[model samples]
Target: MSSSKNTLLIILAFFSIYVIWGSTYLLNKIAVSELPPFMLASIRFITAGLLIFIIAKLMGKSLAITKRQLINTSIAGFLFLAFGNGIVVWALKYVDSGFAALEISAQPLVVLILMRVFQGKKIEMMSVLGVILGVIGIYLLVSQNEVVSKEGSILGMVMIFVCMVSWAAGSLFVGKADLPTNYFVNTGYQMLAGGLMLLVGSLLFSESWSSPNVWSEKVQWSMVLLVIFGSIVAFTSFNFLLKRVSPEKVATSTYVNPIIALGLGWYFLNEVITAQSIIAAVVLLTGVYFINTKKKLVIFSRFHK
Candidate 1:
């Protein structure tokens, strides 16, 4: 591809991860409204993983991997998808989609703190400030009387935090784990593993299983978008941008996703955006920006050794 075309691709790829991923919060909120959360997640991931494998095969890419790689991918899959994402979807049943997205915007802050605790990595001055602001941001975001007073909303918020820890730990694990060289193959394995785990969880939880034909039209469309755009295209674009652009530049999605989620939720679902919530987003994203002020900061980009 020519330079101009390459630049265009990069721009489009960024858009995919930013807008598409940001939109997924609303999409999940929609799907989980009618479907069982675990079942919904399993269906989305399994479908995406299978589609990825098919696409890779058509591209003549190898899908073979060693046992250790498979194991690592499974671990990552559980942490990142089965538990991490699955629980968030479950939480969406009680919390607003935009609220969940805004809370997750503090992910880099959590990742930074986890690095310190697990790997003995030093928190630089800017990151320390980021962490402080992130804490305050979280408090403002979650302490809303109206939001928390809702039945089960507090538990939902707490579970979402746990999901953050799961994703942070997963990011740390993926930073060092040996996996397939091809991003598509690696993602396919991870998604499949995660999906299988979610299926097990669904059965254990006794979540009702229903056929797709029985789903509402809006939910069916939402599921389709989640599998195709949110999981596959957005995630692929994320990895692609990490390779082509600077990690810090790619990490801007961390800042953009919440705003997109908030807007979409408000417009489409009539989810209210509180004044405090808006303030929390500003502080939280600003903190994330400060955390990335250092050149080559991880920003969830394979920071572990």
Candidate 2:
């Protein structure tokens, strides 16, 4: 493919991930009303993982890899999917899905902080300012929603913060790991590993899976969409973008997702969107933009010789 084609695909992949994954917040809210949140997420990921694995194999993608690579992929998957998405699902049991999405929108800024603390990189001044603005935006959004009590809101915010940190670390680990040569194969195996961990976690945490009969059709359909569009389509496209573009660019989807979710919630679910919510969205997006666009720092190492 030409450079132009790759760029177009990259952009499309990013957009697809943003839009599809964003809508999942609303879908999850509907689904959890009728189904156990964590269990539903487990089923979605497991099914999507198997589907993607089969597709990768049929496409003749190589899945053979060293033990180290397998371990790395599993770890990344566990962190990204299990803690990232899994914990968010769990948190939704206590908070509104839209609120959760808005909170996670701070991920780009979190990534910057993680890089500084873990990777010994310097935090850019713009990112520092961006984080401040983004945090204020989050405050405005949550205040507008009033989805939980003040105390519960504080806890919910903390949970999403942990989720963001886990996700950022997982992404960085995946970038550093020597994983599958094929992007699809990597995505397949990672999802499979992550989904299984999530299933086990749900079993251990919830102690039992609720019967399907207990769920309404709306919930069931939402789970189906989560599996099809959220886990399968969005994740595969995300991995594709990872291959075609810089990770920083791919990370921009984090900011875009909240807006998409906010819009879909308002339009489809008739969720109320106040002026504060709109202002928060703008502030958060601007903050994320500053974070993602910051210039990298280059340092010489004495060991380079």
Candidate 3:
């Protein structure tokens, strides 16, 4: 491909990742009404994993990875997909889609803090300021009676926090671990490994398959869409963007998702979008901007590693 074409492809990949992943919050809430959240996520990822694995093989990609790589990737998959994603899916049952997205939007800041602690990376002072702003935004979000009045909303918020932290840890570990040269191959294996673990968790923790609402067509199609768009296409494009763009640029998607989710909620479900919520969202996004400033610094040290 020519330089112009390569740049265009990268831009396209970034938008695809941002739009598709942002849409998953609404889809998750829709699915959870008639399906067990964990079980639905398990089915979505398992299908997506198998689809990606098949596509990779058809493209003449190797499935085999080093044992060390497999172990590391599997651990990341379990933490990020099973724990991070699972918590989000489960939280959706108790929280509004837009609120859930807003809660999890703190992920970029969390990743920065975790990287500083574990990787010995220097964090920018601006990023610390951003974290403070972001926390204040979250307090505003929770202060609203709408969120705190619900029985499980507080627990739901806690679960979403777990999702954010676990995902940060997963990303850090994946960055540290040796991964496949091919992004598709690495993603496929990780999805497969993660999906299997989620499946086990679903079976142990949920009676989804036996639930009266298990086989609803509405729920089934939602799972199908989540797999095709949310898991496979969204994630594959996102991993591609991680390599082609700066982490700060990639992190912008966290802020974007809440807007998308809010719009979808208002349009599809007639959910109310209060003024307070919008203000809180902006504060949160502003905080994220500061938090991601650390990635903008240029490093020229040969002794860094």
Top candidate, metric lDDT: 1
In candidate 1 the C-alpha lDDT for residue 287 amounts to 84
Clashing pairs in 3: none
As for candidate 2, its clashing pairs are none
**Considering TM-score, where higher is better, how would the candidates rank from best to worst?**
1, 3, 2
Better of 1 and 2 by lDDT: 1
Listed in order, each prediction's TM-score against the native is: 0.91, 0.88, 0.90
Per-residue alpha-carbon lDDT of candidate 2 for residues 1-305, written as tens digits (9 for 90 to 100): 79899778777787778899888988887876666656777787888888888887788876787898789878978888878888787677666666678788877777667767777766667778888988899788766545556446667677888988888777666656777777777777788888898888877876467776777888878888888888888888877765554444566677888777777777777767667777888999888767656353122111111
Q: Candidate 3 on 1-305: residue-level lDDT in tens?
A: 69998799788777776678778888888888877777777778877888988999999998889998798778878877888898888898888999888877777778777767776767667877888888888888889997889989999998899888887777556654687767788877778888888889888985456443546776667777788888888777766665555444566677788889999988987878888899989999888767655455343021122
Off by over 4 Å in 1: 1-13, 239-252, 294-305
The TM-score of predicted model 1 comes to: 0.91
lDDT of 3 at 155: 94
Off by over 4 Å in 2: 143-145, 148-151, 210-214, 294-305
In terms of lDDT, the poorest run of 10 residues in model 3 is: 296-305
Ranking by lDDT: 1, 3, 2
